[model samples]
Target: MAKAGNGNWFARHKVITAVAATVLFFGVIGAVSDGEPDTGDEAASADQDWQPDAENDDQSDEAEPAVAEEPTPEETEEPSDRDKTPKSPEPDVEREYLVVHIVDGDTLELGNGETVRLVGIDTPEVGECGFEESASRLRELVGGQAVTLGESDEDRDQYDRLLRYVDIGAMDAGYRLIRDGLATARYDSRDGYGRHPREDAYIAADRRSADITCAPPPEPKNFADTGGGGNCDPSYSPCVPLYPPDLDCADTGPVTVHGSDPHGLDADGDGQACGGD
Candidate 1:
């Protein structure tokens, strides 16, 4: 430890040199930093007062407007009837016509002057059994009323009449006729004609039909018969059955020859009945 020499400034003034050295270190640091690029921490501190033109802080900070997705084809499409149950209307009748006239049990005349024949049924002739009953019934059903008509496999019959299944307010005319024994199911597949959609129903109705049997005439008893009172066919010499119902030679065998030959017992017009046999 030598004593301080006045000529050695650093040794004599240590406190003053220390302060100057600290100042010089900081000045050199500032000069070096200015010549090089600024570090991340220094740049961050410098940007503390910086502001963005938009309100967004980061890429994820922005919220986009919500959009609704369109529905798919399957979701927007209408429902199809593929899975629905098929319904069978009683007759599925479509066309309608006004009945201007009732011709017979199975025939009709339209307001338009067209003729229509009821399909799948046959009624008796004008003079045959039950003819009046059938024709009268038809008039009561559809006379001057509109009726629905359904086409069958057949279109027009040989008579130039439109063949169709007829219905009046849910009532089937042909079916009713067969059911009531007023008509028989005919001109269908059973008869070698076209098969109709209602053929099975018609056949079933025919089976349930009432059996129409025309009553036979009462056996006549002339006072001369010696058995009973007077009820006889005056046309015959012997006087046969009564006239409530007509009969041929088969009923009264070999009737006697007489005037008028009322029952036409004389087939050959020879005035003899049941005698030809």
Candidate 2:
């Protein structure tokens, strides 16, 4: 009976030991699984924090692209006004005509045989002080050249001449004459002819040309002193002492010539006093 009791005690002690070992094994497995979950959660949190930095880097790259594209609109608008400024003159649209003949310093005949009086300028007549010089300069400018005409307020003058502004190549003919001291700026107030488009420029040129001094007229020699026996009065006939001592063709009105041309004022000899028309 003593031996049996000892065996039962020993058996009971072994069973208790086995049950404790199983319990310890299950607890260790649970602890390991829970620690793995905690580690995974920490890793997930780290990944989440790192993702924001990557997204911020992408956003910064996108912001750089936006900044690079910002100047496109301004660059496109810069040429808008610069392109329109050069097209205002439209020189290609002007009409052109051939210059057939140079009537005088300020007048021309077109290829169509129409006479055109240059606007805003008056040159000396045939027998005037600077007539030959002015005519020769005008012929040198537009003779046989294609010219352009600009119209003014009046289309025609009382003498039926077409009034216009003549342009030879790139040059303004009347302005050139005025600048060269060959013409004066003038307008007909009685004929409703208005001031020219370039009147101010022509006046300024005339002012500059007026500085040239002209020689004074010679003292008139009487017909008797010139060995002529013709009875003539300077106020009535084409006599030696023309009303103005330096009487240009335009200034010499209609006068009767009895015997001789004492002043040699009749250039064309049309039986008229001063033939310069």
Candidate 3:
């Protein structure tokens, strides 16, 4: 009976050991599966965080480019020197007239056979103090040259000559004559004739010329007593000697007299000493 009881006790002890070993194996397997899932989750989180950083770096490199500004209106519209120059006076009507003849310092004959009296000034008459000089200067200014005519208040004078202002290039012929002391500024207050835009300036020039003194011509003498042939005699009735063959108004027919015309040849006191009647 004692041997049988001992065998039974040994079998029971072996069964208990086998059950403990089974429980330990299952616990180890469960632990390994849970650790593997945790490792995978950590790796996925790290990858997500690193992707957002790379995307931020790319976005910073693609920042917008800078733009330029435009200019203002004031900088583009500055005035120039050409804008400061004074403009020439406008005329009512401008006509181009050809100068066929220079009558005197203040008269001209047109190609159309019309006589033009230069308004605003009168030069010395033939045989007068500045007559020859004035006539010579006028020829130099407009003889055989084209001139521009500006009409005044009066179309014609009592002498039947067209009254107009003569422009030679950029200069006014009347003003030039007065400025040079070759002519005197004269205005007809009755008809308002000879008045001009530059009247005041012309009067000033005339005053300046008149201030200078000129020698008086000699007394009249008889041409018959001087043998009718001598130097110019200011005292004579004609104021010129006949013997010296001097150029009078008749002698210089239709010709320009640049030098002294000793005889009072220009009967009409025209600037021309000798011209067509």
Best-fitting candidate, scored by lDDT: 1
TM-score, every prediction: 0.49, 0.53, 0.44
Identify the superior model by lDDT, candidate 1 or candidate 2.
1
Stretches of model 3 off by over 4 angstroms after superposition:
1-93, 188-195, 210-277
**Candidate 1: which stretches are off by over 4 Å?**
1-95, 218-277
Please give the ranking of all candidate structures by TM-score, highest first, separated by commas.
2, 1, 3
Predictions in order: lDDT? 0.79, 0.74, 0.71
The TM-score of predicted model 2 comes to 0.53
RMSD of each: 12.6, 11.4, 17.2
The backbone clash count of each candidate, in order, is: 0, 0, 9
* Candidate 3 lDDT, 141-183, residue by residue in tens: 8888889987776788889999888887688888888888888
Query: On residues 1-277, what C-alpha lDDT tens digit does candidate 2 reach at each position?
Result: 9999999999999999999999999999999887765777798888876757778899888877554455666566656676768655555887788888888889989998889999988999886788878888989998898889988778998999999999967799999988888888888443456766687787888888763246777654334234223444443353444333555444444454554555556656654565323
Model 1: worst 10 consecutive residues (lDDT sum): 220-229
